[model samples]
Target: MDDSKEAESQLNEKLYETRMKFANLWESCNPVRFKQKYGESLKITRDRCIEIYEEEKQMCDKVEITKKNIAEQNALIKKMQEDLQIANQKFESNNKQKQEMLKKIKQLKEELAKKQELISTQKQENKAKLKELNTSAEMFKKRMGLEIRRVHGEQLQFIFKCINSKNPEQLFTFLLRFNEEGNYEVMSCDPPLECMPLLQEKLKETNNLSAFLANVRKAFAALV
Candidate 1:
């Protein structure tokens, strides 16, 4: 009976030691204790996740703003391009009008030059004709023994005296005038001779002053 009691006591001690080791290990690995120890680390991890999410959200907002700004800029660029096109069209139209005006001015200058040239030629021709008329008048005065006097602005008087002839006492006087059409006509004769009508008719037909004077001399001699 004594030996069995001692053995039982030894067994109790061993079992107590085993139970103590198990309790110590359980305390070290307890779920509650583990959570308490790592609680601060878990909170730090969660805060980092939140910060990353906020940063991502801010990035998304910035991207949206940037996209909106790009769209507005594109619209402005398109408007500016359209305005430039309209300006170019107006410039081209104005340039065309300017060119046409220049062409018309050149044409007017050419026409004016031609008219000036024609006027100069006509003036020279008129001067030549006036000189010829003066020469003819000088020859007629010397050859026909004719004396002329200005009757009015448009009329002349001519007197012819018969000399070295059978009718030396005879005198021929006539008035010459220009008609409205610038033609010469005999207006009146001093003698009122019967041949005056025939002389006037011939003068109207021929317009020859030399022939008229010769015929007048013959008529005067025949009368003598």
Candidate 2:
């Protein structure tokens, strides 16, 4: 009976020691659950980082669109400036041409006025020359009438030359006449032989001897 009691006591003591070792192992393994929870938190942080990156990409695309619009507006403004410069040059050239045409017209008008003035001066000079010619013809006619009677005989031949050179109107109006025994006479006292040719010329030109002789004695009667 004592041997049987001793064996049961040893078995109970071994069971107590095994139970203590199992409790120590369970205590050390409990911290492994906390490490697993930290891993799940890291996965959530990675998801938030991806969301921020997508928002930044959208902002960059909007800036590129605004820059393209500005470039198009600048090209249109440059073309308009070039067109304005060309138009101004054309207008200046046209104005210069108009001024030259007006200057030429004024010069032509001045030349025409000078020519008209010269013509008027020449016409006045011609009128004075014609008036002097008429006065000289009258003086010559009076001289021819006096000399024929003063120089008698053959000297009367010189008076014939004066009558031929004188105007036709002078010779017909200034000849002398006389009356002898109530009969009309002409060129007798002046040695009338030299006067025959001059008198014959007058009759040949007129074709009216009686009428021409009458016109000479009508104005004056001189003894010759």
Candidate 3:
């Protein structure tokens, strides 16, 4: 009966030791104690995640601004192209107007030259006509002078013949000529007669050939 009590006591001591070990493991693995030990590391990780999110948002904003700038530049380029086209059209129109004005000026200059040439031609024609009229007048004056001299010569010859017929016994002959002054002059008489000297003097004073001939014929008839 004593041996049986010693074995039972030993078994109870072992069971107590096992229960104590389980209790120590449970205390070491508690959820609240683990959180307390690692809380600083978890907070550092969360802050790093917030920094990356902010960087990504800033990059997105910069990309949006760049897109807006590109769109504005394109609009400005289109407006400049339209303005250049308008300026080119204006230049072409101005050039065309200038050419038309130059053409008109050339035509006007040609017309003026033609008018000047026509006036010059008319002046030459008028000068020729005036010269022709002056020549004709000179010719008419010379012809009329010759005719008057011829008529006076014939009248003198007839008068001398009549006077010779009247004076049969005393035949009279005279010399007649034109002097330097284009007048008739009695040079001399063949026989000296009383009327011859007086006839020459009267002819010098009066310059009338017909009257002198008539007076000389009357004086010769009276002497006969």
Ranking of candidates on TM-score, top first:
1, 3, 2
Regions of model 3 farther than 4 Å from truth: 1-46, 129-224
Q: What C-alpha lDDT, on a 0 to 100 scale, does residue 149 get in candidate 3?
A: 21
Ranking by lDDT: 1, 3, 2
> Which candidate gets the maximum TM-score versus the true structure?
1
Writing each residue's lDDT as its tens digit, candidate 2 over 196-218 gives: 45554574566443443433333
Per-candidate TM equals 0.45, 0.29, 0.39
The residue pairs found clashing in candidate 1 are: none
- Model 1, range 55-133, lDDT digits (tens) per residue? 9999999999999999999999999999999999999999999999999999999999987886666556544533443
lDDT agreement of model 2 with the native? 0.48
- lDDT by residue for model 3 (1-224), tens: 88879888887787778777777666657777667656766777778888888988998898899899989999999999999899999999999999999999999999999877876675565445334334533443353211112234322222133334544344444556545443455665545467677787787788555466556556655655
Instruction: Quote the positional error of residue 29 for candidate 3 in Å.
Output: 7.3
